[model samples]
Target: MTRNKLRLAIIGAGPAGIYAADILLKSERHFDVSIDLFDHLPAPYGLVRYGVAPDHPRIKGIITALREVLDRGDIRIFGNVRFGEDLTLDDLKRHYNAVIFATGAVRDASLNIPGIDLEGSYGAADFVSWYDGHPDYPREWPLEAQSVAVIGNGNVALDVSRILAKHPEDLLPTEIPANVYEGLQRSPVTDVHVFGRRGPTSVKFTPLELRELGELRDVDMIVHDEDFDYDDAARAAVAGNKQVLVIDKVLQQWRQREVGSASRRLHLHFFAKPVEVVGDEHGQVAAFRWERTAPDGEGGVVGTGEIREIPVQALYRAVGYYGSPLPGIPFDKRLGVIPNHEGQVLIRDKESGKSRQMYGVYCTGWIKRGPVGLIGHTKSDAMETIKHVINDLGNWWRPESPSEESVVELLESRGIRWTDLDGWHRLDEHEQALGAAEERARIKVVPRDEMVSISRGEV
Candidate 1:
């Protein structure tokens, strides 16, 4: 084995990408190693930058740590560059010794139902993106709505509803985009309902997120007593689990207060499955036709035929995120991922049962293993995959025959424009300036064009 460092290209700048870069940059074998970090957004920190709720300052602090990693002299960051769109897999394989795909699952799972195409129906991802001021989403909170129904009971559903029910004064201090804050200040909605097809015991919200709902001053919280008819054993099973218990406690606390005087309402409805989304004359969601459901005694749910309709103008679906196919990667439609053995991108010969290795191509994050784990899980995953890549570096990088693919040349030839590390500094300055002008925490540009133009010196 030669005493040479490996040249690596990491495809995403989120937790997995940043953590992997951190591991490589901090390694003892620094002599021949270099890294190029690529991201579609001008800014990095994948989910922490766009996916996380704006009010969550604690989680957003991870961005600062990631910035330090990018500051390392051995690393190069290419922002506003997408793999499929700008850089191809073939291109990536040639440019770097090994490429790590950390492009996260950004799409939301669809709820296939009639009238889902209605104007008011929105994916939780889109709603979060809009309010979080993700540069891609046009600046606006569609809260002129009178009522909203969020389908699915997860932390994200809670996040969407909480932001809706929260008073503008309570949210203003947070880093929400100015336009979102303004639209929310005039929200017409009086009630926001969070729904679940299952009972409270199966709800996926964390205790920290559940408790935050209690601090909302403008909205009244409610959980129907009928939602919890679980046997004594089931109740005892969840008694110590803080997340489930927090929901129980919050429901109890809200029940004690007189509810009518509250300006807005946040209702938690369980055992309800949406049968159909009812639309108005103008093709907007007017109401949701929900059927009561209960456990079918075999870990399944059965509807009780009892139906109820609730008026609503907007809906957010937070079921889950699903992966999409990337160019030049073997995609498994059923699994919503590129088939992999550990972190190596697995490609199988169609005629034979044998698996072929796609050399210099690796994957991490939700796309590698199904999108299930939290942010911290990515670190261990990236490390494991990175070990494998680092081990195989000898096959690619060599002193005499070092690969000749230059990222700068490739980008220039394709007319795929991007900003180098210095360009990101300018974008950073612009965002900080916007935040300063607003007298709030870091303000963000939520439009893709704005970010691209700013990096291109058009702004």
Candidate 2:
């Protein structure tokens, strides 16, 4: 007998997966839909809760909308549920009719260069994780460098630069926990240099983030005169795009401002492509070397062979975020995304190079399309996946036990102490209360077990 309802399991509880559930509910499908969201962490939001910097409250505001969706009492959420470990493909096969993987990328995209693995060198993603109170990363960070080099021009590069250069006192207003504030307070950092491979107009930075970089308290912004030689292509970009124009206006304003006498200084270097990370005798970061690049008149740059080396103890590579392959999913290692056509996962036969859909398996967000746009792009991404779910309803799994009660019973049998929506409420209130005592918005809980305990109302 055909079932009257659809049991859907979304592997991530972040914006991507939540958005997919929301779209499914609003879809004009004939069958009833039941969604269950699962996250590996005790919390729901993936990167929004862990990968985002502490000072970016505006970006974090997307949580309000996501929270509304989860709180609607229609969709169920299970926290601390690892897909491959706690719940396997066999488990999902029995419980749900279809599954969507929205596991967004967290690993840093590799930056291939000599001596890139020095002790003082780090990935910007790990730094963001540390400041955001991600429980998995170590609580301590080494902020011993007086001069630091940040290689990249995106928002993440700016974030790492701002956090390293800003006085620790300025970070007190954010939601960063006590440990992060204390770690930053001990920092001896004075000058932070940011390098970009392309010219100013060709930067990947958004106008808002670029402007915010100029507003850091007591920090002098420096843009070299040599880097301002914009080509015709650069000028065309500034004139054609409104966002590019605003960014150019800000950079030009900085160009005009007289260098002020501030204790900390942030230098923005454009048309500089990093070539090597020089290591000292002790195998620690000693300096950074890069080649000056010039526009090739084709919207790209060619190395000018003018190598420059800067003495710096620490370097952060903020190239990009790459996805992790799921245990049972067909992943394209080169692209760091599940092998998919549209949203339907396409698995290839190794011997024949043939392609076919893994029935009912779908992907969305960064895992689906690689890390590209912001939350707005994620909404449209989910639309693509859920559209397939509605159209390919005939291809969904026929579970042996599709009842919600059977799923609950299986979880209880496994000794999995998973968290539900009510548990999240408890943890949320606890964090808010902690922040209230300190006269701040919220103080994030940093321990996995502690978060689970609070969510379970054990303490």
Candidate 3:
């Protein structure tokens, strides 16, 4: 007697989706499973490739582990195949035993403040995508600003601040694309103001990231002495959390340093909550107006009615990322995640008039849980989702057409140009060869058409 094989389809080839495939394949449940990872782009490793800052090669190193998983050959990668346009939820249900959506958030979460729509005001997500050489974003970025303001205190805010203040030549050692390098070279930015709504102890930045700000060459890290005012709650947080302690220590050291004669400066402002983005006559960002905040004794802050204004040529909001709704998934617009309970998707029951699980469909990563944690957090999240999947394995709907070849046949019938694992290898070699000529790690292909062409072996 032959054992039955399970067919799984995972959308979005990012860390979350890939990690799920890895866990499912490595499980000791004694069931044979085949996973087909699908991605809209012509490459895998979604955020690791597109969202991470080019200068942080250490963070990008996570790709090495992800690459090993893909190279295992047990899992199949279908690149350049979109979830909605190329294939639908119905199509997935027809061919796979179960579906997992790991499409992580790519857009910036809105900051609903006045003047946020000003011409010079932009989302940090767009800037990050441009600098990371994402294929979908435009090649050129408006970098003529002399001074900029970055709202938020997370790693992304740091990335935006560092990219704005650092000398363009310093980024050459990394795998920054030609377009991004050129854009950075043209930047006239001299000062970067980073604002946090809470005190220093409540900042979201990790210690290593905070320390790196002070280490940038020719950029003075300036932390105002007044910003160090922490209440009892803030002090308690610093004592309770090791990361907060490290961040506080790093900021204190920066505060004690005498202002160095650097061409560029990065100013850290705590307890400053942006109330409005002031615009000039032409409707371009001219300055930022923020209200002072004080600890509310609950690890949060309250406005103190004291406002201050800082002149800036541009503003970038890096508050957070939000996921978009898939074609047939139940999405919580407010939370920016799929409506789920323990990884099982929830939908409104027509008869019962209550929320219930949508059998056989699941979600993981930022799409399941709101985008909050780092890449390391994705592993544990995936484990939780996978456990739910395993528990529902017995009840998964049986498909009329479950063979792996059925998916290929469907794509062919739809005339969709999909690339396989071999295509990714070809594109990978092409990029590495380009990098070899330049004496760098790898130069990313910046254009979508070019990437598709290279992946298809046309280039």
Candidate 4:
């Protein structure tokens, strides 16, 4: 690397971070550049590997494209390195010219309703992590419930309901871990009720995702015809959005289908808003109570006086994902995002009493904008952030030591065991070999210690 080379650090290896690196490398900049993509997990592809449902391999296929970007040899990968603990903003400033934070939202957003603290109440994010064999989550999940209630209308809510209703044997073909398979096998669930406040036309689910629910093996989907009674606002929305029209059509087809004798049943209930999660004597979830809702003629719904209660042992909330505050970032608590002006981080100056740009610091993905769109939306979000990054290149802070060797020395002096691209390839091969023995796609390594050990070549 030359003295004029710009050393960049991206603090996530997810879609957002990878896309940013790709754009930066492809940009026609005057100076040479070197990028280091960092992730806390030993593996890359953050959400695509840990957040997406395993059965949906099409969504997971995005990993192949991301893999090609890292394989281009212009970017370096630093896996299993935690920000704030392993390195700070000052540490990055000492080695890199600029830093981009792409750490995405992973925690479940709060709904702020009554009885939300009861036992047997789980967040869909945690459930997804467990089922997807995330190394950070617990290996065993309690699935002893016979009837479960899932609240939300997004693809995540549908994923939770479908996974609960689908048989364990049906998931064997996917890359589901052995522990998840065993945990789901013990589930006695026969009914999964999914509730949404809005009508079918206003649902957040993608048309393809919504249609996949109807094709699950041995699981019957039940949709009430009354739930499709849309108001003028919903009708107008469906008329304008082709996706909504397709969703409406698919839902209508399911509503007209004759009920089958499948052992497990998944009921989609619209026009219902959860009010409380009632608990039983043992402090576990006993029943779920919700109020009937009607369209408010504004693409929203208003709760009616009518209330309904259903007996259920477990409840999963999939309202949305919220970003966590980074150690040295200015975060907006209300929006669960880092405060920024067009991807340039904004900080209030103590002397001026006005918000000003934090030079050389940028944000992308859910941390820059709220978590709302699909994975494909991340590319455009990265482009916006990279535009600001390129604009600020003339004013970027020159590091005291910008060489790649300095970064390696810094991590080594701190005794941080970081994995590189070759390490990741070894772990990938290990997983594939494990999967080959089982005749599956790939068996995931569930334990964090094992992941670190494998990546570090200690096993």
Question: What is the C-alpha local distance difference test score of candidate 1?
Answer: 0.79
Q: Scored by CA lDDT, what does every candidate get?
A: 0.79, 0.92, 0.90, 0.90
* Model 1 CA lDDT for position 37: 88
lDDT of 3 by residue, 212-236 (tens): 8888999999888787777788788
Which pairs of residues have clashing backbones in candidate 1? Answer: 134-446, 135-446, 135-447, 135-448
Per TM-score, the best of the predicted structures is 2
Residue 384's lDDT within candidate 1 is 80
Candidate 1: where is the Cα deviation over 4 Å?
1-3, 27-31, 240-242, 296-300, 394-405, 453-459
> Candidates ranked by lDDT, best first?
2, 4, 3, 1
lDDT of 1 by residue, 1-459 (tens): 244656677888888888888876665553576788899888778888788998889988888887887776567888888888898766665555678888878788888888888998989988888888777777765676888999987888988888888887787667777788888888888889999998777777777888888778867777777776776644764676766677666666766777767888889898899888999899988998889998765445789999999988888888888887888888888778778777888899979978877777788888888778887788888888877776766555333323434677778788876876777777778888888887877787767778877877887
Model 1: which ten-residue window has the lowest total lDDT?
Answer: 396-405
The candidate maximizing lDDT is: 2
Clashing pairs in 2: none
Instruction: Compute the lDDT for candidate 4.
Output: 0.90
The TM-score of candidate 1 is 0.91
Worst 10 residues of 2 by lDDT: 1-10
**Per the 3 Å backbone cut-off, how many clashing residue pairs does candidate 3 have?**
0
